[model samples]
Target chain A: MAATNLSERRLARFWSKYGFVLAVLVPILLWFSIFSFGPILYALYASLTNTHSLDPSRARFVGLDNYISLLDDRRFLASMSNVFRFVLVKGILNIVLSLGLALLLERLRRGRNFYLFFIFMPVVISQVAVAMLFLWLYDPRLGLINYLLSLVEIPPQSFIRSTAQAIYSVAIADVWKTYGYAAVIFLAGLLDIPQDYYEAAKVDGATRLQTLWRVTLPLLKNPLVLVMVLIVIDGVQHFTMVQVMTGGGPADSTLMPSILVYNYGLGANNYRMGYACAISFIMFVVIMAITVFQLRLFRSLYD
Target chain B: MTDISLDRRAGGSLPSGGAGADARIRLREQVIALVTHLLLVIFAFIAFGAMMWMVLASFKSASEIIAKPPTFLPEAPTLESYALILREQAFGRFFLNSIFVALPSVLLILFSSSIAGFVFAKFDFPAKEVIFTIILSTLMVPPAVTLLPLFRLVSRLGWADTYQALIIPVCVSAFGIFLLRQFMEGLPSELLDAGRIDGASNWWIYRHIVLPLSVSALSALAIFSFLANWDSYLWPLVIIYEEKMRTLPLGLAYLLGWSSRPRYDLFLTGAVITVVPVVVFYSFFQSRFVRGVTLTGLKY
Candidate 1:
């Protein structure tokens, strides 16, 4: 009887300890199953059928039709190419400028935080507000940018007005808005390089520029890749700036897939939910591919 | 840039006659330093010029804001636009809606993720690794992919256009869970073991031991989650159509068209209201903000 009682007490203590862990873990897993996992599965199903969002049960399957039509869509094609163009040009500029700024900032031992505070100031604010301010700046008649151009005796160029200029204009605004993030990340990376590397470079009497080119940039591969991946993500997901500034055009010139997906999926009176899901899935593939590729490259290079 | 620095460090090592070359290099470095300062000043101007321009423009009359050559300062400063925005534009309602959505969203995210992260980090359970991997992989699915179906589910639950619609779907993030989990793994296991040894329950361990020790990470995630929800545009834009349900960013965007006129003063004013508080808060706690963002990039 005594042995049986002791065994029962040991079993009860075992349950109490491990059981508590399950209690915490179980709810979260269930929540994810319902919210996150369930929705993705539902999205896969929605993409295969013409599902009205309000009445998803009334959907009928029409596989591959949405994807096929998407291939034929002019606006979608334009938006894809536009995003690629924007990402390529803007991505390069952002990386170069942010790296330059990071190097310059690393050189400064004083007033470093002050400059970072302002450079990062724009990014911390809402993108909508930034777009609004740029609206003032890009205005033809009374804008500050045009006024400055006039002072230089250059003709006032219409920004965010013509189709050709619109995408570049929005891209520049976005680069300016977000370059600080890349700069700071680069700064963090620059800071992490051991002093021995610099000292050894100094012993070799390597010029600062050469040392930077050889030592700093080479070691900076991971952060650079990280910055590139982030910029790619931001570029692919570009929406609010485009929406607030151009609304995808003077003529769909600045259209991004993000805004496109949004308009089709959830815009007023246009509930082509199935088609939108297809578009979203395609973009998801592209994003995941880029992220995985870059990350693998970075990991191989760094580790 | 390189010459002057070396000279300073190795000045004593140089012979006395090399002083002339050193001075020349010094002058060169001075010129370079001066140029750097000038460029930085210009950068400062470029960085903050537009924002400051908006603030000054906010105080100006509509005509003055658009005046030729543009007024540098308000000829006559007024709160007229602020008053109108608050009274007519329903700015108060939108601000409250943002707070309503953001506060609960952060609270729920913090609550669930911290508890979940603690267990995932400390516990040895069945299929824990596989389940954790599944949750983390879900981070790759962009919100766009989930938006339509999530909307269907939300509307089905009778949450459309309500604050719950905004809060519930977004209250959970794989990224938050992942971030907290990484932080939790770094925590010392001894404190938790001690708590357990003292007959403290798992809830007690998380609440009393883990939560206090992980305060910094939690604060970072707190500010992060709040700002993300506050700045969220897409999902809220889709779900909330009612004027009363709109958040600050959406309200400001709506004013771009919905205003009787473009109303530069009013537009700038609304933009200022939407952007300034968060920016100002961040400026004061700038270190915390940077740490949070950097953690996102540097950590998993």
Candidate 2:
């Protein structure tokens, strides 16, 4: 009886020490399992099977069929190419404009906050709202852009309607809304840079151009990498604004993989869950590869 | 510039040869400053002007909105479009739905993240590093990879048209947990030890000490998550079937296909309604919003 009492007390002591930790962690881990982790594993499994979204019980193991078929898929190839152009245009414009704005903001002694307030306003608003605003702005006949162009005797161009200009036009809209965010990141990095570096550069007879190239750009690497990776991830996974603007139209000129995922999985007469999952997995792989490549490149360049 | 005049005075007291070079350099600096401000003004104008123009257009009549060489200001400045959207498109309902969904989700995330963060910060346990790494790794997985399975899972649970469908999937943010963990780790452990010496339970110490101190980090998480939840589109578009269940962004997107042709009047007004509140919230907490970005390196 005394031995039994001692064992019971030991068990109670263990629970007292660990009870709170388990209480908090168990529920959180369970949530991640259900919501975050579960979906990932399920998607991976479903990618290998021909599972219909509406009726998953009828799923059959296709064993890499979905992955193999996407190789020659015209729509899939177009989406890959389209997203590449989107990221390119977005990255260049975003970096140039944001870095320039940051440099300018860094120069100001007063009114920095005032300028930043307005510039960063666009970053907080809804993507759909931005998309709506741009749709009207890009409207062919009655839009502001075409009207301004007409003042110079330039004929009205169909921005989203034409296949040639659609992707770039959409990309420009994305850049306009997002570049402010990159500007903020760059500004923080700029502010973190010691003023002594600029003084030293001046002392060495470095011109403004030399100072910018040799001192400023090299010091600004971390924020630059951060902003670039963000742009790629955002550009690849872009759906809402593009989906609202064009729905991947004008003969699929602006088709994105995310849209294809949605279209193939749920759109009318297309319940190819397995195919959509495969596309999603490919997108995942591409993002991971690019991000890893960027980190390595930046590390090598700076380190 | 004022600084140049001050420099001129200082240069006036210096040697004659140095004064000329000083004046010339100051003049060049003045020119650069002028050009910088000019470019910055243009940048600010372009950024702020587009949104301002949209606000003005919302007050325009349907006919005036489509007019050639759009008027810089509304000719009549009527409230008809706002009335039409709120009355006809059920945007009032969408606004309420956005609040109802966002408030609960944001609050839940704050609670979950802070408590979970507290555990990670203050407690010692087995597999902690492994668990935290796993959670952090989820940050790298694109939402596209999880979209189809989540959709199937939610639908299978028969949560297709419910508020729970939107709120629950997003209740616990991995970013929030990670952010709060970093913040909470900086908190003093002595206070907790003092409480524990006084025979306080973990929950009591968390409630009285950790939470009160974590208001700043919690506020940052609150704003970003609220903005994110308010702005979410794809998941709602996938799940919500009922008009009454639509969030503001989803409702605003539907305005595009609401009619045969684009209704700029209603679209602009709906957008204004959707954007104004968030803008107002952001303006009040501008520094926190910026700090949140720096801390997390993310924008919603």
Candidate that would win on lDDT: 2
Superposed model 1: Cα runs more than 4 Å off: A1-14, A296-303, B1-21, B259-261, B298-300
TM-score of chain B of each: 0.88, 0.91
* Residue-level lDDT tens digits of model 1 in B1-300: 000110112212212225456677777766876776677666667888778889988888778888997888788998888898999899988989988888999999999889888888888877889988999988777778888887778777888789889887877777777778888998899989998789887888889989998887787788778777777888888778899899998998888887565667777998899887888789788877776666766321
- Provide backbone clash counts, one per model: 0, 0
Residue A260 in candidate 2, Cα distance off native in Å: 0.4
Instruction: Give the least accurate 10-residue stretch of model 2 chain B, judged by summed lDDT.
Output: B1-10
Per-residue alpha-carbon lDDT of model 2 for B189-251, expressed as tens digits? 999999999999999999999999998888878988988898899999999999999999999
Each model's TM-score, in the order given? 0.92, 0.96
CAPRI band of model 1? acceptable
lDDT of 1 by residue, A85-106 (tens): 8898889889988898877776
Query: How does residue A159 of candidate 1 score in lDDT?
Result: 90
- lDDT for position A291 in model 2: 94
The candidate that achieves the highest TM-score relative to the unseen native structure: 2
